[model samples]
Target: MPVPSISTKKLIPSIAGKLALAGGSLVFGSWVLSDIVHLPGGGAGLLALGAGVWWVTRPSKPASFSEPSSLPGWIRRCEAVLAQFSELELSLGLDGLRSSREQELDRLKALHEPLSVGVVVSEGGTHPTTSELQIALEGVHSLELCIAKPLPVVADAWSWPQELEELDVILYGLPMPLRAADLLRLEQLPTDRPAWLLIRDSVHQSREARQEALSCQLPKQWCDRLLFWSGESADLRQGLLPVRSHFVQPSRSREITKQRLLTSLHRRWQAELEQLRRERFRSLLQRSQWIVAGVVIASPVPSVDLLAVAVVNGLMVKDMAQIWGCSWSSEVLQVVARQLGTAALGQGVVEWSGQALLGMAKLDGGTWLAAGLIQGLSAAYLTRVVGASMADWMALNAGVAEPDLEDLKRQAPLLVAKAAERERLDLPGFADQAKEWLKSQRYAGA
Candidate 1:
């Protein structure tokens, strides 16, 4: 007779089936050993051996082909037990996540509105020529504009229309450079709304003449918003119309002028948005520096202080990266930490801080408390320097540059010095502000 061959596919399951039968037999044997066996120890030993064999040969379930109704009750029970551990009940699906993100984006978009613009023309001065006025009006489709003359009120007292007060931007239309008196009158108006000085004739003037006109015609404070608006090309227009009454059906030239103006205004608005973002980032950096300084002061060990500084600076860089729309990761943090560390070492900031603390100790009766305060101030100043340097680096790269140690090292000292000077001037106010901020944070946490 030929030897029978076992199929490999069926062999394991056959063995497993035998093992399961043996396990049941062992369980029954255990009962028999206790209840009936005359030689109990021998029966118990056999039971244990059977159990071991069953454990070693235990089988996995085969792929299910039966209908749900045919599934074993025990197998269904096992599935129920596994389902309890699954995250399907707790977590959202991909569609849910995408919807949440879109809602957040819509909320942010709702915070923005069209820029409000007001056009100011002095009563005594010449009005903007028809061409100049047209150019100024074309691109301002998004702004709400109103023509206002200097209110004939008391010197240093001018009332803006309620509408103008609500406006976000102002365009001052000047026929010629203002007299000194008019400049002073301009200064008395609210500084809250940003104003632009649109000089009608200065576009064709020499650079020196324009500067002289700005100096003589505008207040020193308003020089920042001054611009030459010679209506030579139809390209230089700004602000929005106050009423639809000012609107007219456009000729081809007028339409072209409107297009150019709109383009220019859009570019300006984008630039303003970028500037506002930078300012907000800088403010956050300043606050972070102050908080880190507080942490350093509270830390007992100098090494811990250093570590905190590095960590905080790294976080600040990460925030700046986000503001600039750059990806932040561990590698970015490491780059920032390395750059800050190198700058600190190169500038002898640590030694300077130590010396400064010692000096402050002498002045403040040499107490530990005084020393801690001084050290904190020093740390705060150094953090500001690091933040300022990082800000400059980000600005230079426009937030897209690869991490470079050499660039950071080179830029740090100059920014550090500037930051130090700023800190010196603003220390008292900053300290007060920081204290208030800390108290608010503590309250919030509580």
Candidate 2:
């Protein structure tokens, strides 16, 4: 007999699943021993077996260490964050971010009504092939095709031609024997829309020469988009199959093209917006870190530690979620804060900060003011790390309809580590900012 296989995307095995299985096995084994075999101490034996099974199958606690901001350490911290936060809370937080991000993405998609495509020839390239491609593309419904004469190849500051701006896609023609100027022109092209490079191989080259041309090291973005052209209509159509996939359809021609174009535009817009969002996230993180540091400086006792940080971070989380277009709810937000707080504690972030502050006091002649500065700085650093890791988490899981918190938890350590490593690179700048902040505080006090 042949065994049948089932495919599933749920690759990660959960503790809950293991526990359920163990419990069922225990129940069955107990019944067999106590009822059928008349075995002794069935209840006690069953309890022991259950305990053993749990001991073997239980999720391991996040590892701890005192390594100074290593990549692995950062990852461990991130994992601890996942373990610390409530699964439901983390899911909700990510879901909230995705909702807002997707909405903005959809809105941008709606605005992408690409009615035309532009064909621009490289400088010194012949116009015959450009005209031929234009004629061939005319049969493509709902896409206006326009041909442009060879433009200036070399410019220090390159900008897209005004005529090309309204076009949905660009089919750029390059002359045979590719020149450095042609590559430079390609490098200057806008990334907003798809740009296909049609290298007109008018004179047939040796197989080795053609291979070398195809293998010519262009940036990865332009690698697959460029191809050799024999100027044949069939070759042009076949080469453009992927681009045509965006809008070409026989049925409901107009509506299908628009809808497909919108979908394609949405993906591109999402990538562009993600870059913008990261910049905004960095600003938010910096502001939030300072807010945390300020709270630490103001508080005479540690009683205000978690509460003040929590309130500040809660608002930060809400802002981040909104930036990502995720829905916001206070209950889930609080849960996220609480869990991450627990992780920070479990991972010795609080202890590390306290020791650092004491060391600062020793170096600064034990002044209370100096101690406060160190404490605040340490708090600020912690905030920056946590906030950065959260941003990473949100980015990684953004479009997921139902985020698997357990899987995220398992990945936390690595994410936290990566964030820590990145933040570590900015340590000099971070320190300079802290010094400036300390000076301002001192001047204010004076």
As a whole number from 0 to 100, the lDDT of residue 45 in candidate 1 is 90
- Highest TM-score scorer: 2
How far residue 84's Cα lies from its native spot in candidate 2, in Å, is 30
Query: lDDT score of model 1?
Result: 0.52
Provide the TM-score for each candidate, comma-separated.
0.40, 0.53
Model 2 CA deviation exceeding 4 Å by range: 1-117, 129-145, 151-171, 179-291, 294-315, 318-325, 328-331, 338-369, 395-403, 443-446
Model 2 quality (TM-score): 0.53
lDDT digits (tens) for residues 271-294 of candidate 1: 543464456566777777667756
Clash count of each predicted structure: 1, 16
